[model samples]
Target chain A: MMKIVTRNLITYATLLLAYTLLFRFGLSSLLTAEKWIWVKVIAVIYGAMIFVTAWMTGRRDGKENFLFDAGFRWNLTTGIVWGLVSEGWFLLGLHSNYESIRMIHIPLLIWSGFLVLHFSLFLILKRRTIGGVHKTDIFE
Target chain B: MTTNDTFHEDLLGAWEETYKKGQLTLWIFLSLKEGPKYVTQLQESIALFSKGTIRAEEQSLYRTLRKFYHLKMVDFSSGKGHKGPDRKYYHLTPLGQSLLQSFVERNILLFFEEPLKDLLLS
Candidate 1:
């Protein structure tokens, strides 16, 4: 389906861009932003995206967000790896001052935003495994 | 009746039981997907789940998702396309796929009713 293709493209493309930009700059740039205003603004936007994404996801899943079964151990590990990988990529970009690095906040925030969902999902799934589904009645 | 139908009847009965008791939160979950959808979209899509069949607060929907978070059947992540917060979204997990698969492939707790009459009705 077109939607699946598009989703895959967007997901992978964003991932590719995240790494590309990460290679372009260093983590230091995050702390050493040319404009603190954009940095904060982007952070707020990223935080919003995190909240909205989780909220929307919650609505869709009906309070049983199962993907989180993997738990915080995996989520946090992936989050850190994701952040580090992007940071490393951006750090690389910073050295050459690549023109490809536009809207620096977008990709960085995306990386952060994923972390939030990762945590939620981890919690959800882990909980389900522990609690078990509500017992189904045998007769109608 | 054939053995298959006989078995399906039993499964169907179980599905009905859970469905009636409100324990089958799993059904509402299948309606939600990875893409963004309005509340109305879900209300219409699920099987035997007509409009107003299960009225819920927007917040309640999120609350139910708490169990799913536990079940590991579904999850949410950030949307790729927008900056706005109005449109909500969700996606199923590997476990959810397996759960749905068990119903279809194994015919475990399969539901067949008048609306979809040809299915294995109990």
Candidate 2:
């Protein structure tokens, strides 16, 4: 479990780092005048990709149990959360002399909140369904 | 040359083409025939089974498993522990077993087995 969490954390952190770098360096130059519009456009596109990918990937399962499909659910949620954090930081506080580093706090909070909610909900649900340690579960 | 160098080249060449078409999915299911495996274990077994010719990326492998679970061809349950997230151990369903059997029969096991042997031996 630690291993999986570590891998997920590393992945999420890396993605967060990459996006932060891009937003700070790349976007600063490209959209000096009307940066907010470009950010909104990118957020919308990112959100769309997330939804489309989730829908297509889970198309095989039909409606039943599709929501529980971890890959689709995780990706879609991650995309939505990420899109919000990525765009929200700038939107919430975009002073002409804003320090980009200060923007990290909100995204970090959102990421942590997401990880907490997702894992807690999943663990609770799994405990209810499987019950405690039992012999049949082990061998079968 | 070392085995690693030989296989790394193969990864960039023939394997990439095959993988793009989802041939790796068979190898994944095939590896689970003996018993259930966690995702990391499954990845290791597949690479060892193929003698380093194929190494599945984590995202793709998990996505495939979820797809299989949705199709009812496979299922998973958590391993014993109260640690972080449960370690999901995946096993084939009866449906998955039949599907794998038919796949092997149609392709002739040699189609996969022979190439792997020839790659390692030669």
Candidate 3:
């Protein structure tokens, strides 16, 4: 549903924002340019977009369903997309310092952020499976 | 609290069944704990914590969540909506929380145990 999509957007967006801030002000020293404000703004914009997707999804599920279990598929899909965006384009661009701003370094930044989150969620899901998993899943 | 005086026993019963039936267990627990929270909150919660069933499948999760609401283990509130009105809310009974606590506690501790914690790598 549109709602779930929006929710996923928001979740991804918020996480992106957090990372942007962390890299910008929190870890701004790494950036050669300290005067740039685009990082924060862009992070908020795109980050919010991600959060929106998560929020919308949440709304669609309405806390009644086990979205935790189902959300994994996206993780795989997101991973493939992120791999291309993050390592693929990112290294290609950042290595040579091509523009490296205004969505230049942004796509991969967002991708990595989502990657970490997705992996974390996967780990959690794996645990829950172990926590509550029955042998049936493995053997049959 | 004493089982006789609290809903813990019933809550645990639900949790036991939760593994067998993922989302339904979660919805039921949420309904008991939060008093009709929006689905947005639940999704965010699961994403953040390793507490319940997540990473299973998308449409299925969506389907089950919807089903519980229809089943009446969950209810919507008049809070408008934080994620949006398009978002629905859920509230769990005290019975539900206690049940969640049982397995959650055990699993949490067990999860942190020897081979699980990666102390070997550490």
Candidate 4:
């Protein structure tokens, strides 16, 4: 569990750093006319990073670690971090008078939908297995 | 090999598989009954005490330990490792000990009764 959380935190931190460098360090200015393009690019990168990190964690931990629902927890933590950073970036863009700053909402809304679906799937799976001893439960 | 030999082998394999499934947990508890142990030590103790009938993967053992920890059946504290960082030494809680005692009395002691003993001997 700690390993999963730590890997997630590191992934989020790296993504956050990349966002800050791109937006706060003149990358936004350089791509003034193509602001939407760059924003979409960042959004894609964020999505990809989340997917990759979650996949790697699942692979490393395997189904044995699901006693705590580690995947769901990972998604929840990732959602929180993604939310905060994107909102902060949007605010920075708003104050800096960057065009199409509202474009950030597109990725935010999509990611939020994904999180809802992930959570629903988790609940369904949990309910289905609630009566039986989890395969991972050695005590069973 | 003959068909009869193959069938006999399959029957024994199936029986062993079913028996081994439930035995792992009992063996784990029995191993902890001796004393607190880290993962490797617990694995070795279980294999030794079970006369090599049970073997557990490291990952599965950790998962079981985590579940036991959460259930308050076991607890652990950091202890020195051979050459690396600290290790968690796990011991059974009072709840676990009582449960084990009850299990032995109810299920195990039955095998020692006169009829069962005579049946086994015969």
Interface RMSD of 1: 10.7
Alpha carbon deviation, residue B6, candidate 4 (Å) = 3.6
Give candidate 4's whole-model lDDT. Answer: 0.71
Which sequence of candidate numbers ranks them by lDDT, best first? Answer: 4, 2, 3, 1
> Which structure is stronger by lDDT: 1 or 2?
2
In model 2, pairs of residues that clash are none
lDDT by residue for model 3 (A16-65), tens = 44444343332233243553476456556655655566556555543433
For candidate 1, write residues B4-121 as lDDT tens digits: 9999999998886666565335445557643434444544454345444444455545555555555576666654435556554556777766766675555433344444555555
User: Which number leads on lDDT?
Assistant: 4
lDDT of 3 at B37: 52
After the best TM-score superposition of candidate 4, give how far the Cα of residue A47 lies from its true spot, in angstroms: 4.2
- Compose the digit string of candidate 3's lDDT tens values, residues B63-94: 54454444343445556644555555556434
lDDT per residue as tens, model 2, A1-140: 01222333344444554554455444554455657777667656545654554455345332222233234245434645555655665676543343364555666667677767776776565553322222122111
DockQ per model, Cα: 0.09, 0.02, 0.04, 0.27
Worst 10 residues of 2 chain B by lDDT: B15-24
The list of candidate 4 runs beyond 4 A from truth reads A1-49, A59-67, A92-102, A106-140, B1-3, B36-41, B58-63, B76-89, B105-122
Cα displacement (Å) at residue B118, model 3: 6.4
- Per-residue error for A72 in candidate 2, Å, reads 17
What ranges in model 3 sit over 4 Å off?
A: A1-140, B1-36, B50-59, B66-73, B82-87, B113-122
The CA lDDT at B78 in model 4 is: 96
Superior by lDDT: candidate 2 or candidate 4: 4
Identify the superior model by TM-score, candidate 2 or candidate 3. Answer: 2
| Cα lDDT listed for each candidate | 0.49, 0.61, 0.49, 0.71
